[model samples]
Target: MSENNHAYTLSDGTSILDLPKVSLHDHLDGGLRPATIIELGSEIGLELPASDADALGAWFAEKSNSGSLVEYLKTFDLTTAVMQTSAGLERVAREFVQDLGADGVVYGEIRWAPEQHLGSGLSLDQTVEAVQSGIEQGIADVRAAGRPIRVGQLVTAMRHNDRGLEIAELAVRHRDNGVVGFDIAGPEAGFLPSKHRAAFDYLATEFFPATVHAGEADGLDSIRSALLDGRALRLGHGVRIAEDIVIERQDDENTYVTLGTLAQWVKDREIALETSPTSNLQTGAIAAWGDELIDHPFDLLYQLGFRVTVNTDNRLMSGTTLTRELSILADAFAYDRTDLEVFQLNAAASAFLPLEEREELADIISAGFEGS
Candidate 1:
């Protein structure tokens, strides 16, 4: 679909930015404010490509949209470079939550690899605790400001690294504090979840939830490993699972399709697909299907009854918010308030929260949609 200048508004003029939303796959390190990055970089004696915040923001956007994952990841190196200390981590995490609250996210799961943040001699446990402290502070600040926001930590293990088990243990240790689940992120092509099978097995044995970054930079095999080996409850940017679906016929109102075994399992089991529209387009995650947002398999997966949820995988890198993502999707797919509510319901159902809290979130979403 053609990009619309006024993409994020409802036909009747409802502002998408005002809608209560849930973010499932956002990265803590990838959502830092440009000004924060500059200040933190300066504090650490690190020279940035751009001395100014706006210029640095533009630089991040440019590198991310360059159609290369390697280049896109290089931007993270800068962000993480400033996040090695407790103060840096705490401030960034707090700001991340505040930004999410401002973006109308009622709840968000912030994922980051603790191992990557240990360059400052902080232990893994210390890093997780620091982030949790920041998250708690952010929540208190949001509540103090009369806004209701809840955030959870999705402790991540870099798939290429050998500390998966250590990270998994760390996530489990903090489960009662702020950690809600475990995840494996990083280069998704060669670093299969199977490589971290020991960690996944350990998490499974402990009954901890896990999500895997699959089907983005990789294909169905990677997704298969995530589900089978990683026991992923959700697929991080699982946009490529569409590759397994065979579209047989299409009419103006209906499309007939056949699903492969993997797609069938993911759909029938209600596995959540965390689809980030702008990030997917920028990273070429949906390139095989098409280049535009409208070409994304999100609609296809949703139509087939897969638990598809909208997300901002990396807000800073993508230069987007969840509101903008949903707005663009609404414009591209002709979605309405009902459609948006359904997405929220799907996300609420798939949240790592307890059943009662998930129900509460669903109720909140229903009430909000009805009021709108």
Candidate 2:
């Protein structure tokens, strides 16, 4: 888990890590290599909780595993501490893409709040440019190794902050550069997407895509706000949308259920639910149903035809990869190769890329799954 690249397998003896995948919910600050964090901490003269790489990574896991929201979020303070300067941001971004490439990700959208990185006086544009440069370098590095990766930035605005309009503008400004779409991360309970209606309105006018972090820390109301106010094309860990579904009864013949208006909208509209299995458990996002992977509503959503996509919300904190996430789900639900391929295809379709590129991604995924 300390190393971002980890091999996974299915019961059928297929190499999960070798399959082409798409990542739409990964965080740039959450996927840093422990070694990189240690080195960057030293350069910035920032005091770290742990001096060694292993210990530092362990510290992150420990904090994130505490199940307390406040404690879980404190881990980011350390990761973002060293990511203030341009060089640090660029380096971390470079390594992030490289790690994703190693994990067999053909396309990924890394999300991070540029507003948080302004502590070191780097302008918002500079931070975006630095990360884009790193991503390009990482792509080149992967190509040099005879593999190719395509990555884009999901410029994020902290939902709890009032910088939504500014960040939204920044994302639109960099639309042609490397920024592919926009997102709203951070605390989601009290800070609903409606709080940033103006920003979403502007994005709608500009016809930009967005994916809001809803139904993770909050419930149906938050998801409603995401669709109605944020105009989210996808739901960032929209796992809690399951809350709106009422199971009337279950039997050998049938399992009866009813979907609330909100749930029906999300499901029928095919809004992608970026469900992160491990992160959901660690963050208490799935505590309502149960405390294990088997209890996740991912299978239910997929069976019900929601555009369910597998993702690693925070790789370092959750100690997982896209490969590992798929494997975990496969084991929990007894999913087969076709099931895993459906998840990949769902992600490819949900990607914020142009329709043609998304179709290209779908073709790549279909071919890979078929070849396997």
Candidate 3:
């Protein structure tokens, strides 16, 4: 409501946070409250960069803006460190949903690698249960507060590790519980999705959905592998798909463009691009395009008919929310509420939920935008 507390407002004096949104590629370990991290870190006797919340938040932002994906990922080490136990995982997951609900997110997919949370002697199943319990509690909390929100876990496997097959199975095992999809995160350039072909193959056989982290730290080839090898239903930060598009000619009246085979396939298939504006800028994912948000190819991809969805990949690290990400895009591209609503609908359509459920989410979003 108030600008002091909310991250964004439109020119019409509308709080962007009041709009219903869908988050397709949000990270669980990356959205913890600073205070929660401090408390959890203390309980585990873990050393933190800053003992206080504000300072710790600043530390995360600073590290994330280092313009290196690898360095940006280092910030997660601290967050995941505190989330090594059931209590820690539950609290983090609970707060994650509460924060999403507060941000006006009607539905969100919280992605985190379970392989990274085993430091406290917890099995993969136990970790999944802990997070699911937190998610249920968080949903109840939001409903009690007169807000309706839905969330699903995108159980992730670190790409650099060899536990992809294991993590994939864990996700499928919990499909009926809270896990809705699977994802592969970590270094993207060298570790192609093909490296986890076995896992993707298994997921394919089981008819499970997956979204691969691609075209952020790498290029078209990586994306190619993600589609062919990972069988990804969506591309996490697939902004770099722009690289495959060539502007053949530009004049005052028109800009002629051509899409490469890879780009053509992606656009034709309507694979969603989980582009996080702030996080992309912070990690230099859009560096090839340009330095500032205005230079991001998100608009190009959007205009070119890509199923682009807005996201806060790492809310805490980027110091952003879904509202803030949309506001930034609106500011840079002069988008209206209709444009914002389309992004939400895109996310809803691309969600790993069943067709009827996705349609329901789309209806909810369309209704909200109409009322607004």
**On residues 1-372, what C-alpha lDDT tens digit does candidate 1 reach at each position?**
112224478887887877788899899999999999889988889989999888888888888997666667878999999999999999999999988887778888999999999899999989998998999999888888887889999999999889999889999999998999999988888899999999999999999999999999999999999999999999998989999999999999999999999999999999999999999999889989888998899998888899999998898899888888898889899999889988988999999999999999988888777776
Please, what are the lDDT tens digits per residue for candidate 2 over residues 1-372? 644333468888898988899999999999999889989889888888888888888888878987555567778998899889989999999999888888889999999999999899999999999999999999998878877689999999998899999999999999999999999988888999999999999999999999999999899899999999999999999999999999899999776889999999988888999999888988889989998888898888888889999999888998878988998898899998999999999999999999999999999999888887
Off by over 4 Å in 3: 1-7
Q: Taking the candidates one at a time, how many backbone clashes does each contain?
A: 0, 0, 0
Candidate 2 C-alpha RMSD relative to the actual structure: 1.3
- In order, the Cα lDDT scores of the candidates are 0.90, 0.90, 0.92
Stretches > 4 Å off in candidate 2: 2-7
TM-score attained by model 2: 0.98
- TM-score per candidate, in order? 0.97, 0.98, 0.98
- Backbone clash pairs for candidate 2 read none
82 in model 2: Cα distance from truth in Å?
Answer: 0.9
The top-ranked prediction according to lDDT is: 3
